[model samples]
Target: MSLKASDLKVGDTHSERLVEDLKRTQLVQYAGASGDYNPLHTDELFTVKVAGYPSVFAHGMLTMGMTGRMLTNHVGDGRLTKYGVRFTSQVWPGDTLDSTATVTGLSEVDGVKLVDLDVVTVNQNGVEVLKGYAQARID
Candidate 1:
């Protein structure tokens, strides 16, 4: 459903659990689908021995995509006009992720109602893994 400008205020928020107990298989699948096999994501041995990470970690894009799912769920399909994010931390297998979108601004530009949102995704430990912003058309 579309959001209405009149029904929203700055600081209003929507949140969703993006993933529970993330899996390595899912990371590998994302690697294959996105064609981003960089070994850091799918090769535990290389990630640990070569890259010196604790283990193979989730791709930043995968976490961003999961956060996007939350945004689309809140704002509805095809409503987004702009979206961007920054990766703040690594996400590992078995971690749970929760994403939140907070209303930052609402306005009518050239008769088109729009909403601005500040997006954040955090892990089970409450560590932010992704941060970003999005703009979307609203009713």
Candidate 2:
């Protein structure tokens, strides 16, 4: 049988994470893949001198990806119908980024199960760098 959000309870925990180092090479790779070549992400010298950032920064989407990964890994096969996030802080190349998601709401619509998650991403400094809601359409 396909998984359903109603199968998950309020206290059902689905995901956990460890902070990952945001590598400079991955930043460049993401820039290549996503076509987001803003100097704040790729050009360190430009970032430091012109953009005034301390060093190369990761794209906000890159970190948001971690949030997506958490839900997808745990929820499986289901498609997220709505996903949006707020970028709270910058992620430097060496910054460790951790992400997790928990089921916070569940409902059904026209025989389809739906789930909502309180997703978040934080750094090693124990600061919340991203916060958002993720919704999945389950069978």
RMSD of each: 0.7, 1.9
Tens digits of lDDT, candidate 1, 1-139:
9898889999999999999999999999999999999999999999999899999999999999999999999999999999999999999999999999999999999999999999999999999999999999999
* TM-score of each model, paired residue for residue: 0.98, 0.90
CA deviation > 4 Å runs, candidate 2: none
- Which residue window of length 10 is worst by lDDT in model 2? 11-20
- Among all candidates shown, the one with the greatest lDDT: 1
| Leading candidate by TM-score | 1
Q: How much is the lDDT of residue 105 in candidate 2?
A: 83
- Reference-based lDDT, residue 27, model 1: 97
Clashing pairs in 1: none
- In the range 37-64, model 2's lDDT, one tens digit per residue, is 9988999899999878789888899888
RMSD of 2: 1.9
Cand. 1 Cα-lDDT: 0.97
